[model samples]
Target: MLSKRLVSCLDVRDGKLAKSVRFVDTKDIGDPIEKARTYYEEGLDELVFYDITASSEGRDILIDVVERVASQIFIPFSVGGGIRSVEDATRLRLAGAEKVNVNTAAVQNPDLITACADAIGSQSTVLSMDVRRAEPCDAVPSGFEIVIHGGRTPMQLDAIEWAKRGEALGAGELVVNSIDADGTKEGYDVELTRRIAEAVGIPVIASGGAGRPEHLYEVLTEGRADAALVASMLHYGEYTVGELKQYLDARGVKMRMRF
Candidate 1:
């Protein structure tokens, strides 16, 4: 089996790294570039940087920040937020992002996903879904709705259906971020993660609510996620990538060991 990946997420606001609880009460933590390099050197499998306010503010992603961070990290990383067109994805790639994640833009114009994939290959396109639990309705039986624009707007789209559509539209991967579970550090929403994971053929990265190595193990194994996107667990110095890997490896979850 392929080793489960542990990806560190850096949510950037005004060029600074920040963390939020349930997508609110955000607090600036540190410099994103510095944090990216730190995680890379610590043996993280991948890194994801999201310009948290770019979409809501009606501006483009922080290209210069992405460039600076990408220049420092040896491992692959994805850049997201306010990427609205194929040109935006191209610019991000040119700036050194291994992948470009689209959320609001894709929801507004889903053809953007195909356009990006056509220009840069499907492997370079990532669909970042900010989802929240909602009342089950005839239109959304999954009980999970897609929230975009930094989790401030609900799109009335069903999460399961959206995941399948994203894959069919050539999205190489999906980052299923549970808004309710985000920054809680309790654990990933296994039901939400697993539902989307089973619905899509592409790799699903479980984001939000990661507190420890055991949480990572559960999400990757029981939740059937290919990777776990951790923020609070590693961001606050509770554990390093190597330490998490050791704990997971000893618990029978396959992880890459950093010597």
Candidate 2:
């Protein structure tokens, strides 16, 4: 079995690392490049930097931060936020990101997915869906609904359906973030993650509500996720990536045992 990955996410607003609950009350955590370097040097498997407010604030991702973080960290990095077109994706890739994450723009124009895949290959394209589970809205049941604009504007799209669509459009991976669970650190929405993982064939990275190592193990082993993405836990010195890895390894959860 492939080892489960430990990915550290940095929600960047104005080039500063930040964290929030349900995408609200966001406060600066630290510097982006410095934070990214800290995680990479600490043996994180992957790093994701999100320009959290770009979509809602109506601006492009902070390229300066992306450029600096990319130059400082050796680990594979993925970036998202205000990424509108293939050109934008290309710019991020050129700026040192191994992959580009798309959210609102993809929902607005899914054809952009095809355009991106044609240019950057599917493996380098990541589709991040910010989901909030609402009971029986419109044509869907009590499942996940996609939210854009940093989880402010609700898109009338079903998260599971979008996952299928993303896979069809040649997306290589999915980041299923639970807005309800974001920053709660209670635990991952394993049930939601399980449903999405079952519905799609690509690797799914379970995000939001990861408080402890067991949460990561549960998400991978029980939720059937291929990986877990965490932010607040690592940012606040709650746990280190290596510490989580060791915990998982001890539990027999597949993990990268070597740096």
Candidate 3:
């Protein structure tokens, strides 16, 4: 088994680090560069800088802000939002991102994955799936459905099946986020993550609902995830990557402490 990883997420909007609950009601938390510097200094494994609304609003991710954050952080950075073509991936990489994450565009054209993989190598492409549960029933649906545009528009496709399709389409890694669980800090949607991990051969990154250090350990140990993506909990000064890594190492989760 791979040692679990702890990644810090930076969701930026209007040039500042921001976070929202269920992808709505966003509030700027702090200057993005400053926040990113804090996490980088705290020894985060990797950093994900999401231009939260770029895809939905139809514009390129803010490279100026990206450049600002990338200038200060030394960890591998994954930048997403409004990346629709292989060219888009190339430009972001040249802008100092290690990987490009695509969601809405890939769902619209699954071939984008193959194109992107061919252009930049699959390792440089991270397929970020935005998912949400369907209406309540007797039991939770065995499959989650893709929710795009920050979970506002629902895609009529099974999330689990889409994950398998993404793997076949040449995505090197996957980050599965629960719209229902994002920023709630209750914990990750572990069951949802487990199913996706079981469905794909690549690493699965569990995102959203991470509130405490234990939540990190639980998702890796119980949910069987390869890595975790955390935002609000870390953004709000609730805990640092170093703090979580130390806690996990002490608890036998086997993550290397960065600092």
TM-score of candidate 3 to 2 decimals: 0.92
Predicted candidate 1 versus true structure: per-residue lDDT over 119-202, tens digit per residue: 988999999999999999977799999988788998889999999999999999999999988888889999999999988899
| Candidate 3 lDDT tens digits, 182-239 | 9788999998899899889999899999998888888898888999889987888777
**lDDT of predicted model 3:** 0.83
Q: TM-scores across all candidates?
A: 0.94, 0.94, 0.92
Candidate 2 lDDT trough over 10 residues, lowest sum: 52-61
Q: Every model's Cα RMSD, please? A: 1.9, 2.1, 2.7
Give the C-alpha miss distance for residue 119 in model 2, angstroms.
1.2
Please identify model 2 stretches exceeding 4 Å from their true place. Answer: 53-61
What would the per-residue lDDT of candidate 2 be over residues 150-225, giving only the tens digit for each residue? 7888887889889999999989899999989888889999998999999999999999999988899899899999
TM match of model 1 to true structure: 0.94
lDDT of 1: 0.88
**Hey, what RMSD does candidate 3 come out at?**
2.7
RMSD of 2: 2.1
| Top model number, TM-score | 1
